[model samples]
Target: MPLRLPPLPALRFFEAAGRHQSFKLAAAELNVTPSAISHGIVGLEEALGVELFVREPRGISLTATGADYLSYVSEAFSLIAIGTQRLPNHRADRPIALSCAPTFASRWLLPRLAGFRARWPTVNVSVDTSHRQVGFPVDGFDFAIRMSRAPVAGTAWTRLFGERFVPVCSPAYLATLRDERGALSLQRATLIHVNAASEDWQAWLDATGADAIETSGGLRVDTIQLAFEAASMGLGVALGRKPLVDSDLASGALVEACAQTVAAGTAYWLVSAEQADSAIRRPELADFKRWLVDEAARFDADVAVADAVADTVPDGHVETNR
Candidate 1:
């Protein structure tokens, strides 16, 4: 038996009208006259033997049956679009869209993008900074890098790296904290805070058993990059996440304020499009996933080396800059 369906044009008109809740608006969207939309809907209702919309003096509204039908129609459109987008003619030059946390994009991912471009010259990458978790496919994002302790449902999650929070400050500022006892104490020093990473400071204090020091008073920066910059300028001490601070720490811009770090247990996760089939069908997306995992692994290896080196330092021995 042949597939029983309303006319394609009628279905389109009804779907548009139901979405906008106005025949006039649907006509404008479909580039047709309001009378045409009305005729299409009439034909659709006759075909289905059901009244889809309640015509009103001001505008049209979906009937109970129409509202239910609209959901299936909209979802069908989305699936059709997804299938079309995965066709071979979709082309490779299309940019891979990724949404990530601002600090991760700035301090970690942006620097390494040149390497990504070097490896995948034909593939372009677009980055959108956001803290909000994205819904893939519907949100039109190929991937999202979210900071969380666990994987998100309905997406492929690849663990990046767990957070290591450490107290960092400028050498000049550290000098100001030193008393006649030749010991540095944060009790008298101002703390720098990031509104988003506020828990870092408390975690550090809790882990180090330095609860006596007041962590409440400080300049609050909105992003991790800004907090790190503020700390490097001798403004105050900031609890820095290792991934964002590793380069600055290695270059002497920011020094460890104490020989203590708190394992935050939270990690960066690369979330692919909701469907595994999407990645398998789109080579560019697969390439992006592979590249991101490789970069994260390289970062973890580097951090491991740094941790080993720091371990070699004798206990309670803090390096002082002359």
Candidate 2:
């Protein structure tokens, strides 16, 4: 049988040494220590049962086998790199990479992304969603959106929107309550609670002064998006993040049964960097920002309208259910 090559990692080391002709140079090129390069090449040579290089005081030189192998190795690595660079664009001709919080990605941002895709038919977007606070340069994120209470310390942070949280459920659930004061009946509904936050129904009850409910029963989820999902499915009433669950509310998947909103102590922001903010030069980011600001203004107007409705309505008619 012909000789089977060693594994990829070992082959790569031998290939580096064959071209550069010095294990030291190969080590430097690969960002590995010299001993690592030596060990890797030794493994490769043992596997191949052939000596491919010669070391001399002057320097290292390639044997006939080494010279021949270098050509194939170089070509292989070049093709591999080209293949890697093209992976993100596999679905399209062009690509734009974006990063954001996973929950925001699943809920609000994703819903709006179709419009961007429709408008820019050629630009494919790859989303990287995570909750770990990722820095721009260190993390290699192109553009990102983040939700937070405090301003980010070292970046060009653009205020996207501030949102309040409210108790929401299917309107059918609300209609069943006998006493309006018991509406925050954490005891009755599945109080779909978000996990990342420190509090649950117990904390919510304490904060809102809703003393009647048990505040102990409910399924807990890791993200606001999941809470909204449960609420939409009628699994429970969720303390909904307004930005995330607004679509659900509008679609009647869920309804805002209470007018009381507990400030979530956080807001969402569009973020990039001072340098990478140049991505905004593409005009897509700017357009999105404009539309988003308009939407937030509309939401604020709705809040004002709700306040007006509450103020004008008589105390008896103001149904205290929410």
* Backbone clashes, each candidate: 0, 1
Give the top-scoring candidate (TM-score). 1
Model 1 residue runs over 4 Å out of place are 1-81, 87-92, 317-322
lDDT for predicted candidate 1 compared with the true structure: 0.81
Off by over 4 Å in 2: 1-94, 114-124, 179-187, 200-208, 211-217, 232-234, 275-322
Query: Per-residue lDDT for 53-155 in model 2, tens only?
Result: 7878888788898888877776666556445534645333334556788877777767777766686666666788744444443234446777777776656
Which lDDT tens digits does candidate 1 get at residues 12-90? 8887888778888778767899999999899999999999999888878999999999878766666765876778887
* RMSD of each candidate relative to the true structure: 9.1, 14.2
lDDT of 1 at 273: 57
Cα error of candidate 1 at position 203, Å = 1.0
Q: Among all windows of ten consecutive residues in candidate 2, which has the lowest summed lDDT? A: 313-322
